[model samples]
Target: MPHIKVVGLGGSLKPGSASVLALKEALRGAEEAGAHIELFELHALDLPMFVPDRAPPESVQRFVDSVSTAAAMIWSSPVYHGSMSGAFKNALDWLELLSKHSPPYLTDKVIGLIATAGGVQGLQAINAMEFAVRSLRGYTHPLTAPLDRAWQLFDQSGQFSDEATLVRLRTLGKGVAEAAKKMAVLG
Candidate 1:
């Protein structure tokens, strides 16, 4: 029963973004499930636009390295327009650095999707992420957290006011860790 690593990636540029708070809450569930967790906030990462054929910067390298080593991942993003934020997408694009790894991009990794939106389109971002997860050769958990009207769930201090949403997000995280553990045993 070795501890698995669960990487949480995403967040908006805003200081108290609901997506980031949700990501942290989800990672807390992973921790409770006996998995080690690492979070890569998009704003802190400051990833540049993905430009093919260019060497990734040191930050991108670190991000990719963590993702490559993780047994499971939980991705959270703020839905902008009809999809994930540019920063979130840019962070995923940086994962191209893992393309040349031993197993390549997200091979055999289990991913859980979460998205926060001001409107009811959060599921759109989750769908977009599911497509990307497939392209990366990762398995997505059946349960997803598409939090709509995200602003209403959090207070000015970024505290989650909705207990139900928190439970759902945490459940998604626990599901990912449990699935990843099963995958590890099977593999």
Candidate 2:
């Protein structure tokens, strides 16, 4: 079976947030392209600020476990004030904890980054986030989905109706899906 684990980090807790919906769409497209996709909400994995002595919570472990086991992952978040949300950053904080000493937490997980913002330049935020993920030893997919004026991109059903937007999202999903499959097979 085509097994892929896709995690989407919603940058905000706002109801009907476009970030979450777009993430879901990416996951759906991945599945359609022959992947078993699971959407992980960063909001649900609440974590205390990363500290030296603090251990990971059960939920955080769950997230780390998913990353460790998945051959591929998709992390999408909306830009918050020109950067990724605190909640999303916090989740990565826990991931950082996995990298104590010379050990790596993300080892070789292939990742796809997505960002949604009110402006077309939201990919700037995605670029910043990609740097973080790469630092943890994760390989990032060059293909990205940075939605512009994302608030108006989706409808009430959380569906992206725009033609070009949908195409980009699908391309991202397919690319990640293929990468995940290859990563799993090679290793």
Candidate 3:
């Protein structure tokens, strides 16, 4: 059986947002590549804003637990202005609790980064995520996905209208899984 667990964290608060669909596709690819996968949509989870001085609620604790057990993760965010959405950023902030662990936050985990934008540009989100992951001591897959004008690619039913986009997302997912497997074995 496949032992690696790859979790996805992203999507906007809006229903049926394209960011959710993008994460679904990437997680599907990870599943196909023999990794167990789950996508956590922040909208549905309704996580509260992270506060350094306050204890986390049950939902936030659950989110932190999920990340702690995962060997790999994919983060897909809807680019707001020039960076990741506040919802996603809040979710990430909760990860600070992991600082209490022996190895600390995200140590040794492999992450795949993705960002989707309604406008003609989205790379900034991915770049920002890369910096965050590195700061958390996690390894990142060199292959990243930054989808520009992402709203145009998905249909009303949330299906991709272009094969190329799907392929790119899938490829990134597979790469992350493969890298995770290697890391797990090495450790």
Candidate 4:
């Protein structure tokens, strides 16, 4: 089997946000399935709002490089006020810069979408994000992992509290890793 690199981009910037926990859950399954992983935290990066007329900042360049180097990407974003969080949107905007350059970074990359929110309504935003990923020429996985009332599902240590949620997350993580593995072979 071909080796795979999995990138998990957590969308939340809050201190210990459940969205970040949810990302950990997904990554766990991927690691167990034999994929090496790298995770990027929104708080750790200094990405700015995307501007169409100008060059992307260095922070944005780092994000794009990370995404480009990965065989598959796990994009985790939180839904805020019925839309993707500003941080999440900013991260995505960085991708648009690729189209401006000679070659795009994510042309054939596989993508797994994940999201967590305070309520069940987060599905709406996840669906919208799914569409955006597809429009970018990415192979968006059909299995999307969305956690509602995210705080209750995960504990303080970023572990899942409920058994079923844990199992489901493991399955999603496996999917991401497996997807990457499959792409690695094809490439």
lDDT (Cα atoms) of all candidates against the true structure: 0.91, 0.75, 0.89, 0.78
Pairs with steric clashes in candidate 2? none
Per-residue accuracy of model 2 over 55-129 as CA lDDT, tens digit each: 777877777776666667788787888888777777777776567533477777778788889877788878888
- TM-scores for the candidates: 0.97, 0.88, 0.96, 0.89
Cα lDDT tens digits for candidate 3, 1-187: 3489999999999988888888888888888889999778988889988889698888888888989999999999999989999889889989999998878999999999989998856889998899899989999899999999997898777788879999999998988998998888888
| Candidate 1 lDDT tens digits, 82-133 | 9998889888888888888989999999999999999999999999999999
User: How many clashing residue pairs, candidate 2?
Assistant: 0
**Candidate 3 segments exceeding 4 Å error:** none
Q: Find the 10 residues in a row with the least total lDDT in model 1.
A: 149-158
**With candidate 2 superimposed using the best TM-score fit, by how many Å does residue 172's alpha carbon deviate from the native?**
0.8
Top candidate, metric lDDT: 1
- The sequence of per-residue lDDT tens digits that candidate 4 reaches over residues 39-94 is 88888885767778677778777778777777777878888887678888778777
Query: What TM-score number comes out for model 3?
Result: 0.96
RMSD per candidate (Å) reads 0.9, 2.3, 1.2, 2.0
Tell me how candidate 1 scores on lDDT. Answer: 0.91
TM-score, predicted candidate 2 vs. hidden true structure: 0.88
